[model samples]
Every structure is written in structure tokens, then in C-alpha cells.
Target: MLITQPSDLDPASPGPITIAQPLLDHLAAIRADVLASLASGEPVYGVNTGMGALSKVRLTTDEQKVHQRNLLLGRAVGGPPWLPDDEARAVLIGRLRTFLTGDAGVSVELIQQLVAFINSGHVPAIPAGGAGSAGEIIPLAHAFGPLAADLGPKEGIALLAGIPGATGRAALHAARARRLADRLSEIGAGAIAVIGANRGPYHPLTARGDDVLAAELTRLRNLVGPEPDPRSLQAPVSFRVAGPVIAHVRRTLTHLEAAVERAFTGVTDSPAYLDGEFVGTAGFHGIDLAAHCDHLTAALAHAAEVSTARLHRLLDPAVTGLPAQLAHEPGPQAGLVAVHKRAVATSHALRRLTLPSAIGTAETSNGQEDVQSFSWEAVGGLAEAIRLAREVAACELLAVHQALALSKRPVPPGLQELLLAVANVVPPIEADRPFGEDLTRLLDSVL
Candidate 1:
């Protein structure tokens, strides 16, 4: 709970920062390397250096501060009007990380200031948009601008280092779309585990899975409690035909998790100048952080598709055995049948966000910028997808809980705990509660 460094970025951690002494040391080591390179006068790129396009330009000792200041300032360009505290905090953490990597030359004192700022809750202003994921310098602009008058050494890259807000908004959310989508996917799985829609679709040996699958299936059932009116799905619906759908979604969540892990832990770096002497590493290199991200998107997309399909099955009067809308009154009430439509729409919206971003590399940067990953875009897409998945989960969890209630029969032990928790939160449909409000709350819980 006394999180003090970016290294402590657990899901439960408030945002993108945790600024501890160890992380500061790691960052300081990077700075030391940069300074050592500069002191050696070894023509190190940024340290004794010239920047982009001017990779050949070397600076005099007298101009070092000016050079560093200019570099930092450029990174601060192009951001939106306002950003949330969490995102600003994320930017601070990213800027600190970049400087720590020795990739950017910054004083350790600045890192300390950032740590204090975060701990004291004095986050700066960051714009919402203007970053395409290759970098988020604009927000970094917001991050460091005020601290350094919106312009300083290595400022340009700093502005682009961290992402915008961590949450999903319609247009301006950051590159976390995939992580959000992964979250949504897991919630979808959780909803499925507790709800008795179609276990038959995912029987382990029935499809293609190993001992792990068997274990996961057992774990899934145990977590949820049990199927209500288990008799209805005792055959193919419960454990037979549903195999394909369940297997497909589980596979997707696993993939999505892999992607988020990569994003969280992956290090993307580039030679401020790719002299090839230093390998001028293009974090924008052969590695596809974006590709991995896109893979996650594809998985989440599959999860959304399958979950929505299951939702469809629940809505079908012929399938779930619930009154048309899981409502006793049906036609008069509009029931959850309409909510199912919204869920499908939400899933589709998430799917739409999954379109790959790395495909469209910027054609030219004065012949210098050959390819751009637009990684921010890819991350952003997955983040949006995750949010959509959450909405779908809200729909699914609610739908199943209602169905179980109507059955008035003992739900299978596998789904009992989660079902009861859900039931307690919203209860089996009382008279016409505003489901939208309830949905918002449900998603907040899972996502």
C-alpha cells in the first residue's frame, strides 16, 4: 500500500506511477551512463549530441544546457486542453522512466520532484489528444511544461513519453484500449462462469485443450457456484455444444492478458540518433509491440463476439426459458431483451476499435521517418475495446443473475457465490429499475 515507484504498478495501484527509491536508482544509472558518454566526448548522440535530422551536429560544452533544454522543450508540443490527474501522473512516471533509462538526460533531482509531486497530489495539466502512440510527448508537454515553463531540455520527447488519461472516453482516451479490453474480457469470462448460459460450448476434452483447460474449467465452475435450474442445460447447452464458444473466449482472454503484460513491461527505445554505432535502437524497431497489442485486440474481439452471442442466446425466449426479457411482464416491460441489443452494440463498438493501428505507418518524415508504429494508437484501440467489453459484461452478468432468480431453484454450486453477490447488489428484478444506472455501477465494479 505504501507504493513509492513506477515498478509497483499493480492493477490495484492508483495509476501509472509508484516512484520508489529502487526505480530512482535505476533511472539514475541510466543518467550516469549518458553523462559518462558525454564526458568521454565520444560523440554520443544526445549527450554530446545533435538530435534528429541533425544527428551529425555536435554541440560545444558551453551549449550543453541549451541543447538539453531545446531537446526537452520539443517533446512538449501538441496536446489537448485538459487531462485527468491519473494520466498526468502516468506522464510523470513515464517521463521519469524515460530519463531513468538514460535514453533521455535528466537530473535525478527532477525525478525526486516528480515523486514528491505524485505523493503530494499536485499533478500537472495534460492535454487529451495529439499523440498517435509512437509517443505521447504532448501530454508530457503538459507534464513538464509547467515545471519548466512548457519548454526545456529533452522536453520534446518528454512530452511524448507518457500516455494521456488511463480511462476510456469516446474520442480522447490514451493507448490503454487493449488493457481495458482485456479487463472487459476477463469480466465477460467471469460473467459466463457464474451464469448458466452455455457451458456445453466449452467442455475441455470435447474441444481442444489440455490438463490446464480441465483445471481452468473446474476453477471457473467453482468460482461461480452453479447453474440455476441445472436440468435445462444438463445436456449440450451446459457442457456439450457450448464447448466451442467457451474455449474460444478463454483462449482470447489468455492472449489479451499476454498483450497487456507486454505493454506494461515492454521497453520501447530508439536512438535519439540511430548511428548504428550504438545500434541507435529504434524501440520503433523490428519488435511489434503493436503487433502484440493487435493480437490482444483480436483476442478481446473474439471474446466480445462470443460473449455477445451468448447474450443473444440468453435473450432468445426459445433458449434461456425466461420470459421474453427475463421479465415476468415481457412486452409491457421491454425487459432485458432491449438491453441485449445494447450489449451487442457495445461489443461491436469495441470490435470496431480493434482495427489494427500499426498498419498505417507514416509515409515520410523528410525521408528520415520511414516507419511509425503509432503504438499509442494500438494501445488506445485496445483500451477502448476493453471498456466496451465491460459494458457487455454488465449486460451478461445481469442477464444471467435474473435468469437464475426466476428459476427459484437451487443454482449449481459452481455459480452460487458470484451469483449471490450479484443478486445482493442489484437483486432479482424489482419493479422497473433504471437498468442503465445499474449497468454503470456493474461495469465500474468489474472494469
Candidate 2:
């Protein structure tokens, strides 16, 4: 894609990337200005002067020539646990956004090379761990350092600066979470139908005041079709509260999406060039992205909590009015008792990951760079949370399908297709052959 602005970038797509011509021309102009500033013996941070604590110290012309490449070498301290190619592409794209405003003082050639690297499908070995720097120097160095040769005055600082790593990963996760939320709609509807839950909570009146809730309510009603006779006056809390919980996930997803847009559009290079001056900036700090990732993590956990609880309720003969454990017979068959254990374990792990990563900060870099944001860790946690959430959703799907099969109640026409699909992979729990295999197959079928 030829990206001219932040809105042009799609987090879900990792196709070939190209910079817009206007931005390239802008980069050329900025590079010329940087050369002029260097010619006049002006001290540009990370160019003619030492970096960080040594910023006050000046360098000779020879040292200046080699400093840019050395900067990369010195900070490539992290190892192993690399980002996947798509994520690496997003990070490079995010880095390209930093240069789009012409504040990074890098040559158009350097930008073109970076774009070529992304388009070429070259995955920079950026460590997923060791995001301990106040800024992104450690991971950025590992990412762009290989391309650091022949760099210009401020190019190294341009490459070393910014939260592209965190923001890019967050953008990808936000997209994944959105898809998971969509899938959960189908699963939630299936569960409601199987249990003959009241549609009163999803009535049009309750959807008022929140657009996400309204949309989810509509989706549920469509998937569930006309409601059956209520199993009771009210279904369990997990079923009744699903609309709002999913709305909360969607709401926090909006927050993450907004933060990602801001990160890509805004200038994030430290010591950014502005109107012929090299000025220091804190745009590299990524607490905004980290905090929003944390929020989404928490939201997914809430959704999972509801999902697992609903799964447990599905097993209750009292709730579904089916045989205990959704089994063919209570005494001889184990039914889905084992699946609930896996969901419980997965739910516990998901909850443990909800701790705010942004709050787990510390100082580093001899006080020159301190107060780390732990943005990378937050994005990583969000990725794992999404994984676990999907697992929980898969477990719910198994229960829903099993409950639908066991119940004598009429299945909604809207849910018939879903039931057929699930039943194909997960056969009826006729005699309780290993259900772990069923869950694995169901995950493949549904997810």
C-alpha cells in the first residue's frame, strides 16, 4: 500500500509498503537542511555530539562519520524472542511514519531502503523481550541497525528513537481483538439459544445510549432469531450481561485504535528537527499505547470470565435442564467435565496477565534515560490475552454445541448452521470419548 497518511495504514494487512512521493520529497528537503546545519558547525544531538549523558561532549568530523553506525552496534543488546514478520513490517511502517513529517532529518535514500526492506519481506531480528529502555533504542537498534550503514547526520537517532515497536504491535493486536469480539458474538448467541435464555436483556430498549451495545444486541438477536420460552424468569448473570461486557471490549478497542492512529501520525523522534533547529522531544514515550493495551487486556479478561462461567453453567443440569455434565448418562460418562478444567486454567492465566504493565516501570541508562514505560511488555501481554480469550471462546462453543444437541428444546433456525458446523467437528457426547480431541478439532473448525 502507498501510505500518505495515518488513516491509509491498515493494521490487519501486511502487504507491500511504499512511501508517498510528497513525503519522500519532504524528507529530501529536510536532509538538505540537516547538511547545511552540520556544515555551519552547529551541534546536532546524536550527530556531531555524544548521545544521552554525553550530549554535552562534542565529536570530531571522523567520529561523527562513524557515530551513527556505532550507535546501532552499541545498543543491540537484546537477543532471541523475535517479532513475527507481519509485526516487524508494522513496526517498520510505524517507523516510516516518524519520518513522514520530515522531523527525523534522514535522507530519502534511507527511507526508501527501509521501505524496500519491508517490501522485500526481510524480518529484522527485533527481540520481543528487553524493552527496558526509556525509549525504544534497544529494540529499534536491533531492528534497523543492519540498515544503518551510509546513514546521514541524524539518521541514527531517527532509527533509534520512537515507540514504533510498541505502537505497531498494539495496532496488530487491536485488529485481532476486534475479530475475536466478532467471533464471540456468534458463540454468545449460540449459548443463549441452547439455554433458551430470555431475550429481554437484549431487547431494543436496553441497547439505548451505547452504539457498541446496540450493535452487539442486534447481532445477538439476528443470530438467536426469535427467543424460545425462557428457561427461567431470567438466565444466568453470564448470559444476561454479555452484551455490556462485549461493548466494553469494543469501547476499549476504540481507545487502542485511537492511540495507534496518534502514534503513527504524530512526530515521535527524539531530538526532532524543527524549522532549522534540532530540538529534543519526549514523543518516544509510549505510556498512552501501553495503558490502552492494558485496558484492552482487562476487557478481554472480563469477556473470558463471562465465557468460562457460561460454559460452567452449560454443564449444570439445573441451568440447561439437560443431563448433568452434558453427558448422555450421569454415572458412567465423564462428559465435558475435563473441558471445564482447561477453561478454568486458561481463565486463571488470562486474569494473571491483566496486571497493568505500564505501572511496572523502573529507571535505566545512568539517569540519562529513566522511567521506562514497558510498552513492549504491555503489547505482548495483550497478544497472550487474546490467545487465551480465543481458547475460552472455543470451550464455550463446545459447550453450546453439546448443550444444543442434548436439549430436547427446539433449536432456532438462525442457529442451525452454527450447530451443524460445530457438530461436524465435535460429535455428540454419545459415550464420552476423549473431549480434548474434540476441543482441538472444534478450535480448528470455529477459529
Candidate 3:
């Protein structure tokens, strides 16, 4: 769908992107205001005078155009093949929003034209790992590739302020990963439910069952199944907590979903000229989105940990109430013993990846860059967290399936459907099966 448009932005989740009108409207307004101020010979910081160290110097009316034009031309020093599709769109739209308020003095048509280029798929190549301080100066160089030829006084600074390009790519990656985490937790929780293992930490209940308790209970009954399976007795309690565990993961997805929506449609602005007034504020800062992404990343990683713990329980005969690793004979066959090691390692690694990026900062770039939202880092980490979670979920599904098979008994009523769903694709293990092949089929339904 065309994410740039309001209609398109409404239904979408998150990922790569494009731009739409609010961005254009923003740019047009900024351009007109700057021009009007220039035409009136009013002394403004960027629109009429030199910038940075040179801001005190005033420009003549004719020189104002020269200065604005020169700012775009000279700062056009942005080196690149160009920015990636998603980042470019983010930058373009982000930059457009800045000017749209008429503070930056950028032309409306110019902003519209840039969005047009994006819609047409004219992606400029941008490099990775350009982590400079001072509001993503290096990344902005690549981000501004499209509008290189035309810039205003503070326009370049506005465009470069806080590398939203990197942030965009990171946001997209985080969103995709969080969804995978969601699915992983659901299937992982499902496996836990199948085994009936004792609950550990994460609960669906808040301290006050005031809002989500009933809602979660309703969801539990609706999604988990009607009765427990007897074969599922091998790991009795696993299927029960699946509801709340899955619910925790569900909350994370809800946040990621909102983040993705904003990836294309968010208008971060401060000092924006809304309607007819110059409204100065902090919308330009993306701390809110970064925080949301950070929270999701951390929560999803925990979800992975919860699932991995459940997979380990499958190996404990006392835990699963069945053969170790759900082995058929229990003595000779290794069963799921080694399989769980993978799950444990994967979960640990994902948890490590969950370290919040929003708090990351450094004093660099000649001290021009200090604290940072680290939004890009946060989003980038999310994708990794998501992938690891999928692997972990696959492990749980296999473990649960194996535990049920070794029961040598009927499956629990509630777990029966989930088991059938698994068995529909996976054959019972005899001596040993190709682990990879078994994992692949097992994950077909869950992962």
C-alpha cells in the first residue's frame, strides 16, 4: 500500500516507506514564510543572514536569495550513491515536515517534487554505519541526496538534525523483528501450554486486574482451546499459561504496530508554523518513538526468555512428567536433550540484544554530538531480537510435539488440537530423525 498517504498509512504496519501530502503542505508553508520574510527585508537567522559562526552577518535582499541558494548548493556536498529506499523516504518526509511549517523557508513545490521522486522509486544509495555526532551529519549527507541541489540557510541543518534516516531504517527493522517476536512468543507460549509446565515470572495480569484481566481471560478461552489433551499430560500445565504469556507478547506488538504507522506518517516538528502562527516546539525530537521501540525490544526479548525456559523444562522428566527430551524409550534416545541447548543459547542471545538503545550516547564529533536517542540502534536491535525469537519458538514447538508423542497416551483435550496441528505436518519420531528437517516441518505451522 502507499504508506505516505493518510489512507494508506492508516491500515499499514511498518517497514520500508514513501511520502504523501502533509509533508508537502509543511514544506510549502515554510518556503512561503521564508520568502515573505526575505521579501520584506526582515533580518532572520538562516533565511536572511549567514549561519553558524557567520549568523551575525546580515545579507542584502539580493544576497539573501544568493545565500539561501548557496546554502543548498554548497551543502550539497552530501556524498553517496544515495540513501536506501526506506531511509530516504524517512529523510524526505522528515525534512518535508520540518519545512512545511514555513520555518525553514523551503519551497512547497520543492518538497512535493521530492516526495514525487520517492513515489517513483528513485532510491538513492546510502551507506551503512555512518554514525557521526551532531544530529547525524554524515547520515544526513546521504539522506539529503535527493534535494542536494536546493537548500536554504537553516534548511540543511534542519535536514541533518538527528539522523532520522538511520532512525527510519532502524525503526523498520525493529518493527519487522517485533512482529516475529510476537509470533514466536505466541507459538512458544503455545508449547508451554501444551506441556503444562509451572509458570515462572511474566504474567498477563497487571497488579490491578482492573483493565486487562478480564480481557486477557476472554482471549485465553478464545485462542487456547476448549479442553486439555491427555497425551499432553507428559507436560501438563504448559497449555494453561499460554494465554497470559501470549498476551504479554501481544502488548509489545501493539506498540510496534503504532511505531510502524508513524514511520511513514509521523510529523516531528518544533518551531513549526501551523496555520498562520510560528509554533516553536519539540516535535522534531523523536524520543517518544525511540522509547516505544526500546520498550518493545526489551519486552519481546523477555518473551523469548520465557519460551526458552519452557523448552528447557521439556528435558526434565520431572518437569515434563515424561521421558527426558520427550524420548520414546526414555533411556537410550537422546530425544530433546541437545535440542533444548539451542533454545537456551538463542534466548540468552536475544535477551542480550534487548539492551535499550535509547540510552546510548557518546561525546564525539568535536563534542557537537552528545546525548542521542539512538533510535537507529534500538530499531536495528529489534530485528535481531525477532529472528532469535523465531528460532527459539521453533525449538519449543519441537519439544512440545516430542513430549506429547512419548506420552504413549491420549493427548489432553485442550492440547489435542494444537498437537494435531503439529502432527498434521510432523511424523512421530522413531529412533532419530533429521533434526533440521523435523524442525523445518514443525515450524511450518508455528514459526
Which candidate ranks first by TM-score, i.e. highest?
Answer: 2
| Cα lDDT of model 1 by residue, 315-336, tens digit | 5666655677677687667677
lDDT per residue as tens, model 3, 1-447: 343433343211323345556665655655666556546665555556665457668877667645644654444344534444665565555544444334444565555565566566565555444443434455555556566566654455455443345445554555555556445544554555455543422233532453443455454444444443433433433344445555666676576656655643444432333554434334434565667777776776776667777777667876557766677766777777777788778878887876666565777534534666665555556656666777777777777777666655455455566668778877877766567677777656645
Each candidate: RMSD to true structure? 5.3, 2.0, 5.6
Better of 1 and 3 by TM-score: 1
TM-score of 3: 0.71
**TM-scores of the models, in the given order?**
0.76, 0.94, 0.71
58-138: candidate 2 lDDT, tens digit per residue: 999899889999999999999988887777777787777677777788898988888788788778888888878777788
- In terms of lDDT, which candidate is stronger, 2 or 3? 2
Query: lDDT per model, in order?
Result: 0.53, 0.84, 0.56
Residue 105 in candidate 1, Cα distance off native in Å: 5.4
Instruction: Give the residue spans of candidate 2 off by over 4 A.
Output: 408-424
